[model samples]
Target chain A: MAAESHPGYGMRSHRSTLLRRLLRYVLLVATALVVAFPIYITVVNALLTPQQIAARPPTLFPLHPHWGAFASAFSTGHLGIFLRNSLIVTVTITLAELVTSALAGYAFAFVRFPFRRTVFFLCIATLMIPMEVTLVPNRETIVALGWFNSFPALIVPFLASGFGTFLFRQAFLGMPGDLRDAAALDGYGHWRFMTRVVLPMNRPVIGAFAVFAFLSAWNQYLWPLVVTETNGVRTVQIGLRQLQALSIDQTNIIFAGTVLAALPIFVILVVFQKQLVRGLTAGALKG
Target chain B: MSDTRRRRRLGEAALGYVFVLPALAVFGVFVFYPLVKTFVLGFYRTPPFPNLPSHFVGLSQYGSVLTSPAFLDSLWRTVLFVLFTVPLGIALGVALALLAHQRLAGIRIFRTIFSSTVATSVAVASVIFYTLLNPEVGLLSYWLGGRGGAGILQSPTLALPAVSVVTIWQNLGFVFILMSAALQSIPDDLMDAARVDGSSMWYRFWHVTLPLLSPTVFFAVVVGTIGSFQAFGQIDLLTQGGPNNHTDVLIYSLYQQAFVFNNTGVAAVMSVLLFAILLLLTAVQFRFFERRVFYGR
Candidate 1:
C-alpha cells in the first residue's frame, strides 16, 4: 500500500514541475518579443512607403515597399561621397591605431626600459581625462596646423587612443616570458619577435578592437561637425543631420534618411553582436 | 667581454625605443601640442581662416566670460544634467545588472536586448529619437495624445528632459555591461554565505555588493559627469541649442561663440573655463579614491 501511494505522488510532482517550466518558457518568449519589437518596427517602417505607414492600426505589411529610397539617397545627394569620406576616415584611423597600439602595448608589456611603468601609467591616465576638456585645445592645435576642414584634421588628433594602449598593454602583459626567451634564443630580436609571434596571437583581440575603433571613429559627430563644413569632406552623419534640417516639412523623408543613416550601424551590430559583447565585457572586467 | 653581445643588447634596447617613438611623436603633435595651445589661445582671438593675426586680448576675454550671465546659466544647466544623469545612470545600471544576474529563464536574451542599443551611435540614436519625438508626426504623441497635442521635443520645457531620456537609454547599455562585469567578479560564495547567516537578498546586496562595487561606481560617475558636460551633438541636432537655447551646455555654447558668432576669443575663454572645471573635479575624485575604494581587502 505505501509503495503504490508514493509512486503515484512522485509522478504527480514531476508533472507539475514540467508544467512550471512550460509556463516559464512562455514568459521568456514573451519578454524576448517585447525586447525585439523596436528593431522590428524600425526595419518595417523603413521598408514601407509613407502612405502605408500613415494608415491606422499599422498593418504588418506595406502596400508598396520602396527600394527606391536607397537610389534616391545615392543619386539625389552626396550620400556616395559621404560613404567614401567615411570609409577613408575609418580605414586610416584603424591602420594608425593598430600599428601604434601594438607597438606601445608591446613596449609596456614586454620591454625593459627606464620609467616604463610610469610611462604606461600616464598613458592609462589619459583615459580619465574628459574628452570635452581636451576638445578646445585639440581643435586649436588642428587649426594651427592648417588641417581644419581637411581629412587629417579629423584623423590626426585621435591617433593616440588611451583605451587601445591600455588594452594592448594588459593583453601583452599576460604573455608568457618563455615565448620571448625562446624567440630570443633563436636570435629573432625584440621587434621581429613582436611582429611575428606577439601580433599573430593578438589577431583575435586586434580584430575586436578594430571593430570598436572603426565604430567609434565613424560615429564621431562633435569633432567632425566642428571641423568639416564643406560638402567635399562631409561624412554620412553630418550629411544626414544637414538633410534632416532641410526636411522639417517632409517628415517622411527625414525619417527615411535617419533610417538610412542608422542602417550600417544596425547591420554591424546584428552581425558582430557576440564579438562586441565579448570585447566590451572583456575590456571592462579585465581593465 | 664580448663587444658583439653588448652591441646586440644595445640594439634590442634601441629597437624597442625606435618602435615606440613614432607613436609618441604622433601623441606629442596631436595631444600635447593642443594642450599647450589651449593656454596660448586663451589669451588671444583670431578670425577664421584666409586671415591671420589673433589679437592678444590678455585677461579681458577671460574676464568677460567669468562675469557673463550666460556662462553662469550654462554652468548651472550642466550641473543639473550631471546631477540628473549620474545617479540615474548608476541606479539603472545596478538594477539592470542585478536583474540579469538572477537565475531567471532566458537571461542571456534579456542582456543582449538591453545591450543592443550600446552599439548604436549617439548620432544614430539622436536622429532616430528626434523623429520619434517630433511634435507632429511622432508615434509616441500619436499614441499618447489622440491628436493635435504638443510633441515632447517641440515643447521647450520638455525638450531637454526628452533628449536626456534618449541619452539615458543610449548610455544604459554601456553602464549595465560594465557594472554587470563588476558584479560577476563578486563570487556567488559571498552571497551564499550571507544567505546562510539569515540575511535577505537586499541585506546581502546592500552590505556586500555595493561596498565591493564602489570603485566601478565611482569610475562610471566620473565618466558620466564628464560626458554630460561635453554633450553637444544631440542638443545641436534636436533642439539647435533649444526651443530657445534652453538646453545649451558649455560645449554647445563654446561651439556657437567660436564658430557661429565668430567670437573665437570668447569661445576660447569658455573652453578654458570648461577645462578648469574638469581638472578640479578630477582632482577631487582622485583624492577620494584612496579612502573610498574597498578593493575587497
Candidate 2:
C-alpha cells in the first residue's frame, strides 16, 4: 500500500513538471513572436504593393507578393550603389582597424618603448572623447582635405579604434608568456612572432574585433549623412534616409529599401553569431 | 655580450614605437586634433558670411551658449530622453534575459529572437518605427488610435515619447545580450541552493539572481546613459527635431546650430558641455554604483 501511494505521488509531480514546461514554452514562443513582429511586418509590407499596404486594418501577410519593390530600390533608389559603397567602406575600416589594432596591441603587450605607458594611455584616452565632441572639427578637417563626398571622408577617421586596441591588448596579455619566449628562442622577431604565432593563436579575439568593427562602420549614420552629397559615396544608411525622404508616400518601396540595407547585417549576425556576441559582451563583462 | 644585449634591447624598443605609430597618427590627426579644435572653435565666433573668418570671442560665447534658453531646453529634452530610455531599457532587458535563461529545449532559437534587435542599425530601427507610426496607414497607429490626423510622431506631446519607444526597442537587444551573458555566468549551484532552501521564485530572483546580476545591470546603465545622451539618428530620421522642437535634444540642436545655422562657436560650446556632462555622469556612476555592485567572487 505504501509503495502504491508513493508511485501515485511521483506521477502527480511528473504531471505538474510537464505542465510547467509547457507553460514556459508557451511564454517563450509568445515573446519571440512579439519581438519579431516589426521585422515580420516590414518584410510582409516589402512584398506587397502600395494599394495593399494602404488597405484598412493593414495587411499582415503578403497575399500577392512581388519583388518589384526590391528591384526598384536597387535601380531607382540607388541602394545598389549605396550598398557597394557601404561594403567598400565597412570592409576597409574593419581591415584597417584590425591591422592597426593588432600591431599596436602586440607592441603594448610584448615590446618595450619610451613613453610606452604614456602612449598606451593616450590611445585608450580617445575612448573617453565621444565622437559628437569631435564631429564639427572632423567635418571641417574633411572639407579642408578635399575629402568631402569621398571615401576618405567616410573611412579615414574610423581606421583606428581604441576599443579594438584595448581588446587585442587584453587578449595578448592573457596569452602564456612562455609562448613568446619560445618563439624568440627560434630567432622569431616581433613581426614574425606576431604574424605566425600571435595572430594565429588569437583568431577568436581577432574575429571578435572584426565583427565589432564591421558592425559599427556599417551602422554609421551621422558622419555619412553630414559628409556625403551624392550617390557615388553615400552609404546604405544614408541611402535609406534619402529613399524615405523622396518617397515618403511609397511605404512598400521604403520597406524594401530597409530590408535590403539590413539584409547583410542579418547575414553577418547569423554567420558570426558567436564572435559577435563575444565581442559585444567583452565591453560589459570584462570591465 | 652584455653590450650587444643592451643594444638589441634599444633596437626592440624603437621597433615597438614603429608598430604603434600608425594608430597613434590616426588618433592624433582625427581624435586629439579635433578635440582641441572643438575647444578652440568654441572660443571663436563665425561671421554670417561663409568666407568671413571667425573672430575670437574668448569665453563669452561659452557663457551665453551655456546660459541660453535654447541650450537649457535642449538639455532638458536630452535628460528626459535619457530617463525615458535607460532604466526602462535595462528593466526590459533583465526581464527578457530572465525569461530566456531557462534550460528548456530549443531555447537557443528564442534567445536569438530576443537578441535580434542588436542587428538593426539605428537607421533601420528608425525606419521601422517610422512606418509603424505613420498617420494614414500604420498598423500600430491604427491599433493605438493614432491614425488619420497627425500620428504619434507628428503630435507635439507624443513625439518625444514615440522616439523614445524606438530608442528603447533598438537598445533592447544590446541590454538583453549583456544581461543574458551575465545570467549565464551565474552558477547553477547558487540557484539550486536557493530552490533547496524552499524560497519562493520571487525570493530567489530578488535575493539570489538580481544581486549577482547587478554589475552587468550597472554596466548597461552607464552605456545606455551615454548612448541615449548622444542619440541623433532616430531624431534626424523620424522627427528632424520637429513638432515645434519638442524632440530637439542637445545633439540634434548642436547639429542644427553647426550644420544648418553654421553657428560653429555655439555648437562647439554645446559639444564641450556634452563632453563635460558625460564625464560627470560616468564618474558619478562609477563612484556611486561601483560600491553597490556585488562581485560575487
Compared with the real two-chain complex, what DockQ does model 1 have? 0.30
The docking quality of candidate 2, as DockQ, is: 0.45
lDDT of 1 by residue, B111-204 (tens): 7776666765677668777765655555556665755444677676777787787777778877887777787777666666776787776887
| Interface DockQ per candidate | 0.30, 0.45
TM-score of 1: 0.86
Inter-residue clash pairs, candidate 2: none
Interface RMSD of 2: 8.1
Residue-by-residue lDDT tens digits, candidate 2, B1-297: 699999998999999989899899999999999999999999998888889988998999999998899899999999999999999989999999988887677878888899988888999999988887777767788778644434789888899988998999888887888888888877766777787787888998899999999988988999899999999999999999998999999999999999999989889999999999999999999999999988778
Model 2 chain A: worst 10 consecutive residues (lDDT sum): A1-10
lDDT comparing candidate 1 with the true structure: 0.72
Considering only the true interface residues, what is the Cα RMSD of candidate 1 after superposition?
Answer: 9.3
Candidate lDDT (C-alpha), each: 0.72, 0.89
Flag regions of model 1 displaced more than 4 Å.
A1-39, A54-64, A113-122, A128-131, A134-148, A246-252, B1-6, B45-54, B103-105, B146-149, B196-198
lDDT of 2 by residue, A40-127 (tens): 8999989998888888877887877988999988887899899999999999999999999999999999998889899999999998
Report the Cα RMSD per candidate.
Answer: 6.0, 4.5
